[model samples]
Target: MSLTSNIADGRKKKRRRMKSDSDISRPSPMQSHIDACVSFKDKQVAARVTSDAKMDEWFVVKVINFDEKTKKFEVLDEEAGDDEEGGVQKTYKLSASCIIPFPERNDPSGTQEFPAGRNVLAVYPETTALYKATVISTPRKRKSDSHVCKLTSNLLCAYLRGYLLEFDDDEEDGALPQRTVPFHKVVPLPEWHRQRDLCIKMRLNSEFGVLNM
Candidate 1:
């Protein structure tokens, strides 16, 4: 499948038009936390980037605590923004399921799937260099020590391509390729918020449709 399907120019890809689910897979990181994450999906909103430039690194953010007053999840932003009266604020309101969790693959194999647990979510904007997102939940280790970290759509693609590229290089030179390792980490969102945009960009890709892996 081509990576340029729904991408419009260098800045936009409409999710409504995304018609493929081929890229969706159950990577190892989400094996333990999937159920916990599904429980919070309806209460979150995710932000992602459309440009390839922003997808190079990982975005780690903290999930906003559930609110009882407005009955919506609130996200914190390190970037300053102006209010209607021009006051600076660092928080925003997100719609339900706007953010969801995905598992990050470390040493990803085309033949394995992990059990579900907790995950984080983010949103992808139309014209940004990277997807913007907020962390939705803190990871808690289960009895089996199943811990998972979600990845942005761009990151997932990058990880696969990068590994493949390296493998190809080794193969062409008549050398055995090294095993591929997953490029993901499990960290606290609040601690990593200012470090990375802390988000993911994803759309359904028909070529990588949801495989129960």
Candidate 2:
């Protein structure tokens, strides 16, 4: 083959290889959704009823079935009293975004643990933001491993139906309002501190600052 033709073929092959690599590195939409969806096996979860006008109350439920095609779950409301077989089980279909899984028992394999007074990044249900919070109460042994967290924000606390609306804050405070949240939603801030520091460092770097700007 001529030198010019050989060079062109090599370049085309390189482009095809790069394109395939990029395609393999990018996750499919369904895979991304599945990765973000909270696993709802045998554990109890809190789900917000979007159909309700207020959308403020969260119903604690157990997952009976998950429909992958619809991305919805068939849940049995635990708060509702039991009824006869097939009689008013209080079942509802909920989307993944509306469901929050309860925290599992502190196991040796996992690092997320809610000890009283410990600072944590809690998933604030009202705003769906992970904010700085303090563990006011730990989970009871018999009950679901849900922890009561006090948000550190100074924003006015509002109670609508059964949900507490609070702002996200990075500051420290002792007088913040408390709300109950699943233990799994409470992440230890220390584990993320290093990443935050690295981000700060990169933002302050001269080259990075100029590039980001």
In order, what is each prediction's RMSD in angstroms? 22.7, 15.4
lDDT of each: 0.33, 0.57
* C-alpha lDDT (0 to 100) for residue 155 of candidate 1: 29
Residue pairs in candidate 2 whose N, alpha carbon or C atoms collide under 3 angstroms: 103-184
- Candidate 2 regions exceeding 4 Å error are 21-25, 35-38, 79-88, 102-182, 185-213
Q: Compose the digit string of candidate 1's lDDT tens values, residues 1-213.
A: 356753554334444335233235444454334444435433322332112444432332334554544444455544444576366534555433333333344433332222123222222222111222222222211211112123434323444432111221235457644332222322222323334433422223432355533
TM-score (C-alpha) between model 2 and the true structure? 0.44
lDDT for model 1, please: 0.33
